[model samples]
Target: MTDAPRTLADAREWARVGTELVLGAVADIGDGEFDADSMLPGWTRKHLAAHVAANADALCNLVHWAATGEETPMYASAEERAAGIAKGPAMSAQELRAWLCASAVKLARGLDGLTAEQWRNKVVTAQGRTVPATELPWMRSREVCVHAADFGTGVSFSDLPAGFLTALVDEIAAKRGLTELPDGPLPEVAAWLAGRPHALADAPELGPWL
Candidate 1:
């Protein structure tokens, strides 16, 4: 994406686009399909949907921290996070799908309620990096978009908006300590950084960036 969303307005809009894309895929899923393996190893479609819903809940914690100046973490512990995901398989298909939709709506409402000053408040990410609250939208944007593709129902890297993909590629490139975008087309570079399949045979092995 030549003009990847950097502004707060853009980020919010793009995040919504990502949410819609993924949820549409979710909507089309037959009950039997939830047990199928997703693009992510060892995770079924149900687990993927569960994680995405839980992620919105986690981000809402950050939004609370930013809004109130309290020190709330995304997850109390990694085990707690895993335990949240572990709850998915036990849920009925309707229950899990409703949870996914509601969580996303709740998170979006929470974010929209913040004032400009609150948006600038410093907050710590799950990775322990302190960034302005503005980054939350971007974080959410990345989550829904990448995971949208991971479902492998129909949405894919190429299905994502170019600007959003470009932004994701640039952010992941910097994380890998590269000053320049990886040598490939936008979708390929984004796919590579996202730990998905890419056509770049020359790409180096990378640890998880999510």
Candidate 2:
């Protein structure tokens, strides 16, 4: 059977862990490393950093929409989102780090302050999927955790929580075909789901999910 959808509280805990993992990896970035290529093709570490930071701010819009009944969209438009990511690397490494951490904190606070009713408010993702506010934590958790590994630091699917990994693989697999769990442990399945190198030599080399 498919795994049950994660609860808001449980998903928020996953996001918290993932945010810390990303912050730790960012903390380890040395000079020149920001410009260094990441596991994601043609993207430097700074690109990943910028996207992660902007995502927090973008996601905050949905949190606000849920909290206030405001019609806040994740970004003004798709072009605006592209422009923001394009300009992200222009910031100094220190400035970028602060922006990422602060945005993450702000998003966390927004989620923490929501009432039960607020949590049930409907919001649309940047991808145009309509979902309840409860999905916010799961969305953010996916971003931080996946990008942490994408940064090409020590973090990998194996480093993530088993519950999250299992869910991630299941989610990605759903997109590929709404398929069932592949025969493997959560981590290996995650690596395959993430299109990263794994022990599954037969795994297909899927391109970037985004």
Error of 2 at 82 (Å): 1.1
What clash pairs does model 1 have? 1-162, 1-163
Candidate 1 global CA lDDT score: 0.87
TM-score of each: 0.92, 0.95
180-208: candidate 2 lDDT, tens digit per residue: 55576678878777777677656667766
Error of 2 at 48 (Å): 0.6
What are the C-alpha RMSDs, in order, of all predicted structures?
A: 2.0, 1.4
Candidate 1 residue-wise lDDT, 1-210, digit = tens: 343447887788789999999899888888878988888898988888999999999999999999999999999999989988888888877888999999999999999999999999999988899999999989999999999988888788888887788788777877778765557778888988878888887788676666
Q: Give the TM-score of candidate 2.
A: 0.95
| Deviation of model 1 at 206, angstroms | 3.5
Q: After superposition, how far is residue 102 of candidate 2 from its true place, in Å?
A: 0.3
